[model samples]
Target: MQNSSAFKKRIKRRISGRPHVFFAVCPPGLSGICAKEVARVSQKAEEIFSDKYNISNINVLPGGIEFTTRLKTACLANILMGSATRILMRLATFKADGFRRLEEQIKAIDWELYLPSQTLPDIRVTTHKSRLYHSTAIADRIKPILHDRLFLKEPPRHYDVTGSAAPPPQTLMVRGENDRFELSLDMSGTPLYKRGIKKKIVKAPLRETLAFAILTRLDLSENDIIADPMCGSGTFSLEGAMMQCALPPGTFRSFAFEAWPGFEEKSITHARNRLMAAARTDMGVQPLPHILARDLDQTAIDHLKQTCTRHRVFQRICPVCDDFFNMTPPPIKNNQGVVVLNPPYGIRLDENNDITSLYKEIGHKLAADFKGWRTGIVCPGKKEFHALNLGLSTMPFFHGGLDLYTAIGVIGR
Candidate 1:
């Protein structure tokens, strides 16, 4: 339909195109929820790829989402998604009941398109229900072919497989199941939840990724004032403030895609611009007047301030040091809001070893101080939390442990 020059121009528009994308997740139970998040993000932009993409599966067994997207789209996902653990670039999938068949499939793909000749790739192989199930043997079978494809004289020895150093920034993961094999490359060198802004640390700080997951489940509104009375290192509070900005979880982190052979400059710049455009730029008008955090430990409040400052979110969060029993709710522009509590319990912290009384005291405070506020609390079990006498609903959350899930209800409703 077009001339040769026009065709060249069309090809120029697609950047770092790839065949497929896979977003690694956690806890087989959360696969459906992760699928919703993946779809929500993918609809924003699909032009980076040369053609339309399709979602293949929401894998419950391996805990990931498999979708067709370009390499550029993978880069965008690494910067934008919150629920995913890692973004994997799929190479090829084929029936491989034996090592010979596996090697043949690996040899067919164009490895040169993804890896520079001089770099090293960390290889990880896993097997389930396949005849060629020896992980070490699978690695041995595929490694030589990759080395040959890159024309490396000798494979680099003693390099850490998961290292993010300069020489080798790529990781290849191969999974064999049911007499078939699927290969993928890791586009996110470091996990996405490590936002790189936590300058201060606490003993049992909630994982940032998990924090975002809990926030998403709460369905928070920008207008809802938020408070975390037992905020350790300000994880929940900072997460709430960032949501007001619509900021991507990996906004400040480096990605493994930055080092790929197919890396493109304008593509990443465009992706960053796309994310920034999605960002809430209303600086003068914040979502809520109060997203407050308080802790009995002065060290935690100090750490919260430090972490928030390093994240450039100091103005948006309020940190206080006072015992939950003695402290009153922070005043907000609105009369109603949400109160979050991730109190220490069950060998994590709970230093005094008195979860029963602590739980009772928290219940008393909720009735006395927070009459109309919605509450989200992380607790070990519903029976223990129900002792507080709040009529809250809960779902099983796999992180921290199988015992921990978030409880949601309204205090004195």
Candidate 2:
């Protein structure tokens, strides 16, 4: 990539300088898995963009990875970061011990770099252990400077902020900790989790980013068959097909960077062509048979069918309406493959609920029918997990505002 004269010229003409960006990985449940996904993709990024944008540094944050790369590499990071929630572009970082210092730092950073005069800026701020420790105070301090410097319009709030007029396409976040100030622009507008195709969601649907992480644990091959027996709205199966086809997860969505300077349609088209081309080339194996996905509810199957078709992944997934506990894994060329399940996790589920019996039956089916098959379950707690009684190596992670446990092991091993 570094040797490509075309890429070089694109860099010079489009992204003439370096821009720092970071990945916001999700999983209110487990930061470790997020780390693993970030690490895995970062290596791939190095292999692709190493010539133009070597990763200068990597630091672990509460729910993500803070890493630095050049301006030209942001699109690749967004396209490739499977577990990220948002890729924030670092705009400025300086000392801010007080309000005056904060104003100075904001003033020194060029707001026009990302926010065009016609665009609106949404600001979020957090402060800790410094003279300016109040988050609202910090936001209040920075608002006027943004308007005065960039000629930007502020979204007026009345009874509610959402009631405010919808702005064009930009947001700013200011963070301060221990007298250090840093500003980052949201490069991924809708948070990487929302691809807009997961509309048939059931209660407590698995976040796509977290689902991708679970699918990654399998170390899959083209020869391996992938199935999600409890596939509500088919997140796991759809994600698996996308991974197999080497499609970018954000293929259908627009990004915040597209509205910024030097990121015209031509540049975006160039980057997308290169990224998709490389992905296609690297995917050496043939796409597998339809990803096996089943759910008890016929409505869910119907919805999964519609959603998958909308996302253009319908052809790759075979949706069935059968109860997971009552059914066996579908026959594939490989008798031994993998089954991933997302069961009910009601925070209010108690001893009176049917989950215990459901999990027990699920375990019974796995032992009786799915011998030698790899199994993974996203369950709520020890009660449901122990019900499986499969002695699965566990990975604890959170999803959809709920804490959950993941268990994976070979069935009847």
Candidate 3:
């Protein structure tokens, strides 16, 4: 616990120059939630370290937020924010109307600052409404320049993205629009949604980032209980329980930034340790709210039990193999709670599935047994969404290539 103060001073002293530009990427239409999470996490960092993390200049774009912050804060944001899919460090942006101009722009960046000589850069490019429209052609043009400039002396080698045979390749993202391009380094090698703890999954499991975003819309309090009646693999319950327990999303994973130049491993390790220590201390004094994770499929319940037990959060999440329609709301202290459901879309599990009956059953159960409780359901179609018969407002979003809406309402008002 005492080590955090020293770590705090080191971070405060190191943020001297102009802040770096970073973009927190998320699913389209949820950038607003991701931006809010960034602010909330930075505020918590300030309260803990007694210093500003300098996470400012938040510009919300169509798919993500661009913020200016020091490298350490960017690293911390990767560990803390759950809604962001990944964070990218913007290196440079310039006009690239022709291959020569593209080469010039690429040559201007100091590759050594971000990439080591031995690693093959994994570059991904996308272009729109530009003279240089072919993505592969753009990447092919940039690769040779990078190779000749960075690996002039080293023996040539091939490194796959998996890094199983060699070290992980640093990912470069190039996006071109109207003859101008933005180049960024992917600070997160793998998507942030794969937190490594959600090993147990069923058909069409919800992404953790999406789950976190839905929970953020709930406005949940510490005293509010969470119930996932159709909890296939327990995504909603586990995410909510983890939040209530103060577990950072990146707890069990490594990031691409750890392999970058001048990473400050010792300070980052200290900060992560401090965050874990604080979570433990907070959990010791605070009573955890109950998370009811129920599934009709016994196999799903069994898998969820294993995951919860492996992570030592079994006590907070009560898993049962029972049909959701047969269950009633569990007791709550304040009569305040929410029920979250991600029902089958009738396309994956079974072609003959009757989704309307399912939604109607869900709505009837909630109205009869869960009065005054808030609800969130992933409705795949208007027919199914209206079957609920609950006066819920819908927020449209996309997931799994399907246009969907998150229907939210209070039951039995």
Candidate 4:
């Protein structure tokens, strides 16, 4: 429990590196794709920084990917990445075998470098196989020390652990494993899946991240047409538009790092501008492929229309109010494109709750209309996915607390 000068130095060394470590939390079963996106964003960050910002140590684990880069680069990564759930930066690490050691080490670290004036940390603590096992107790011990450091310049505000007050700029993760602790700051305030544009949703709308993950598996490109026959809320269509246009996913949203101490506002702005410029340059004179968003529900079609118009991709997306069974592919050169389907599952079933018949009908319809075209369908399980009978490869993933599989393959292959 001794807070020696050596311990203070160790903490400083852990937190003061010019190249900070960051982890991109991804959806389960999609970490490989997320890692690829992170690497792509890292290359873009290097271009934006215009300096030798060495991005290295990209290690892909089960649920996330870890990498190291400059702080500004990490902020740009947060904006440019498409598949990650969020990004977190490792702030400090120390060993604290008991409450006294934890408290002493917490007091030894400098907080002003990370926290702005008059700000409090929203601490989330978790402990496993450690002496300080109570998460609430550890958070309680650490909060007052952070408060004392952050409120020195301004009047202290009342702390509310219930979160009735406005959300703090940063969320501090305090993870303890076997007497060792790691402190990480949430760089993205909201989860990356929340693209912040769709104001309307139908029953059981697909998540944006899952949509993007499926699109990635299909090798989607700007030249390839996208058809979402069961386009509920048009998540797949919207994500497809963003990808085709090379638009940064976080452009319409703000991040938690924007309010942190010593955030390079100018640099971040420059990076965004540079990304937009590159997108514009890449889209010169070449028309984006049409994304046909079709559904039987007129209300769903109307909502998709509004969203596409609001996002300024209305021209690129053709919203049609027609049953998928009665639909035909638009006149393209070779009908070489991708068809995505997120039909009803679980409680959103038909009157007889016969999903197999519905899936079989869908498979027949796609086989007839979209021959040689790639198709992706999200189903509740392998049993339902197999009902499609498209010979599509299946991958398991989780969304909305349900185990799901996306069937992917070319129709009539």
lDDT, candidate 2, 1-413, per-residue tens: 22257644654553546556665656565455556655555565566544545565677777677776665566556666677788787777788777887888788866655554545578888777877888888888788887876654533211111122433257898888889888888877778877656657766677888777777776555556787888877888877777776777876566666656544445446656656665532322654656789887788898888887664544778888987766656665444587888876575345677997888888888888887777778888888899998878887787666667888778776
lDDT of 4 by residue, 67-147 (tens): 988788788887878888999998779999989999989888777666655778789998899999999999999999998
User: After superposition, which runs of candidate 2 have C-alpha atoms over 4 Å from their true positions?
Assistant: 1-15, 19-23, 28-51, 152-169, 277-287, 332-336, 347-351
Tell me the lDDT of candidate 3. 0.78
True lDDT of residue 392, candidate 4: 88
Off by over 4 Å in 4: 1-17, 154-169, 281-286
Residue 19 in model 2: shift from native, Å? 5.1
Sort all candidates by lDDT, best to worst: 4, 3, 1, 2
For candidate 2, give the lDDT: 0.69
lDDT (CA) per prediction:
0.70, 0.69, 0.78, 0.80
lDDT pick, better of 2 and 4: 4
TM-score between model 4 and native: 0.89
Q: Please give, for residues 162-245, the per-residue lDDT of candidate 1 as tens digits.
A: 233553267898888898888888888777777767788787687777777777777767777788889988888877777767
| Candidate closest to the true structure, highest TM-score | 4
Q: What is the C-alpha local distance difference test score of candidate 1?
A: 0.70
Alpha-carbon RMSD of each model: 5.4, 6.5, 5.5, 5.4
**Each candidate's TM vs. the true structure?**
0.83, 0.83, 0.88, 0.89
Worst 10 residues of 3 by lDDT: 156-165
